[model samples]
Target: MNSLDTTRIRSYFDFPAAGRVVTNNAASTQPPRELIGLLQRCAPWYENVHRGQSTASRRTTAMYEASFDTIAAWLNAPGRGCIATYRNTTEAINAVMYSLLTDFRDGDNVVTTMLEHNSNYVPWHALCREILPRLGRRVELRLARFDATGRLDLDHLASLVDKRTKLVCCTGASNFFGTKPDLSKIRAIADAGGYPQPTGERRALLLVDAAQLAPTSALDVQALDVDYLAFSFHKMLAPFGVGVLYAKRHLLDHALPFLYGGDMIADGGVTTETVAWNDLPWKYTAGTPNILGVIASAQALRLLLDMVMPTAFFGGSGPLPRVAIEEVMARVGRHTANLTARCMAGLSEIKNLRVYGPEHRTPLVSFTIDGISPFAIAEALDRRGIEARAGCHCATLAHRALGLDPPATCRLSFALYNTPDDVDLATDAVRETVAGRRRAGRPRPGRAQVSTAAGRPT
Candidate 1:
């Protein structure tokens, strides 16, 4: 087994696990000491940024801008690309969707995949709704289907993407299945399909929601050749209320701002009120912005990068490409394999347990027992000192796609810090709960009933 120093990671998170299994990385990650220290150091400088003319405000503003530069370097975005700060991934998605809808005429279609997070799915779908009525032309929306293995159907995806498609929104990785779509292939498809004369044919702009990929792995924006990318720092072990939306500066120059406010408005007249927008990123990023959160997020990015540097994470002697996600996943797969083995072994002892998602999937496993509801399973595990996520983890459409309606299954996600022992403990708890229910010959009291929703399992 490829060993990970999970004890060290647990120490870093300061996990207060008196006992039982630990399984709570999917919701949010724990920031390291350095990031926490960075936040604490700047906590006192909470003056209003961009609004104040004072030196304190100036310092904060400078720091905030510097944070953007740091993030750009971390993402390896184009030198002139704009990194507009935002509230979260949802806001970033909104900005991009607004930009696309404002620029493109009606009847222009958006091609996305089933693997996308709701943040990526909702905005574009809403945009389609808004624009479809304006012109007689209908807005076409398509979802690239995934195979039974939960991997993207690349051939089908390519077939769906055509000249009418104005934008292709894809995720860097799936939060549900922990499947990293082959971005290199997606980029190739985009390059082949995108507009006019240069690369033989023109197609659609590729926008990647890197919310899941960026924190866990490095990205090369140029190499990917995507038109736009968005991610959140909160999921990357940074403080909340800070996310990034990166687009080629030229493209951003043409797009309309999603919101209009202080920092984004150049000037406005008092009379009938005429207003001019700011330049590039600042045009989209309205108001004072999340200065402290930005700074802290930058620190958080550095912390995660340091921990999973290409050399250490990838397990090779020669220098690994910092932005190669496949290499990282290959390494992570090794980690997952170890955990999976332990989990499967322990789960084998249990009767009537149904694990969801792809078999031989990542460390994450969404499952249900024959007679128990997801909530009961989560509660049972919680009482046993193990924590897991239950319910339709925000991907309502994904659940529907899986043919599961109403409440979802229990989702146990693993982090780099999670150990085989944790998996064993979790499996033990699950087995014990199943056995208890079976022996009692009755449904456990307070246990929830099976969901009546109608989506297929992914």
Candidate 2:
């Protein structure tokens, strides 16, 4: 059963009235109506932040700046200096790649897992396979494997890290497999790899793509001891635009700016001979940011707390107590976990289907029927008013590594708002879809085929 009053939480969204069951939450969670209202609430005073002299600018700037604190507090980071916003998690991770580009020595390597979403894997791939090589650096990229049960092979991960390993990029939760690695254990392995940093630290830096974890769990960056962590606001009930990257304060202080332009420079500190960079975060924020989006994303977190709990503990702007965050997110984690368990149980009952990942997953299920096309399953589910996602879910590397011919699967990922009823509807759709395909023995044009079979699949 869900830990929160899901019926009441459903009231905060518009999907219920519209009869839309959004089970594809790993791609993006539905934004609450209140987040839209929050954006409307900021419409009047919305102005360029840090660049204007007007009162509206200062007011909007305060809200924008305060957004970072909310994000930092949500992750239990040291302070706002560690936070940097981007267009999405993909961009946020790419920023890390660029900022650390020059630091990679010729003989260095990066250790990442095959279970990573492309957002985490592709950036490192390009850094090692494409970009760094073009610059005359032959930095190697090593992939740690996941077992058939979808858990990261910690032993395999350990074997890949050594003194030459510079960074270890991992996914906190797998979008396709729904596996969650032991982050603390991963940290221990990363630290065991004694790479000499320019900062004199003898360890491989750790970067976690928290895209799946952040939406449901309360995370403590200090506790994880990760050097870099990235996640998208869209996965957590905010609008589609903003993503975040959290680094240690010293790292941000030392790394080069990802994108350099107008606002990132210190005021009048730019001379023709010497250009000064702006302080902590704005040094990373190059131009006019998604000011309204940042404010709304922060407000989304506040609204989330009020939705899950009995009281309004967070507001528009104030210090967000870590205790409050831990409480609210624990409820969210429990609710989603129950929904995922229900999904897994329902999917298990569907005949001739293979569900990926371990029993304890991060609120998602990806599976394939023996003879049905995954895309067709998604299409059939959509026709039933049950939203589902098909394709690799950008976990192309994992899908390919698993020996999937076309490298895809139909995925049903849950959130705090998902209900037991939603899981039934999704699995029922899949069961019926597979049954329908079986009845029609021959391949039809423009439809799913049991490509390996001449007739109906048993």
Candidate with top TM-score is 2
The segments of candidate 2 whose C-alpha lies over 4 angstroms from its true place after superposition are 313-315, 442-458
Highest lDDT against the true fold, candidate: 2
Candidate 1 residue lDDT tens string, 227-285: 78998877766767887888877677677778876778764522355677766556776
lDDT of each: 0.70, 0.90
Worst 10-residue lDDT window for candidate 1 reads 310-319
Instruction: Tell me the deviation in Å of residue 173 in model 1.
Output: 1.8
Cα lDDT tens digits, model 2, 1-458, are: 32789899999899889989999999999999988887888789878999989999999898899999888888889889999999999999999899999999988999999999998888888999999988999999999999989899999999999999999999999998888999999999999999998888999999999999999999899999999999999999998999999999989989999898889999998887999988888899998889988888888888888898776744567777777788889889888888889888988987899999889989989999886888989999999889999999999989998899789999999999998999898888888887788778766667665545567543
Evaluate model 1: give its lDDT: 0.70
TM-score of each: 0.83, 0.95
Candidate 2 clashes between residue pairs 3 or more apart in a chain or in different chains: none
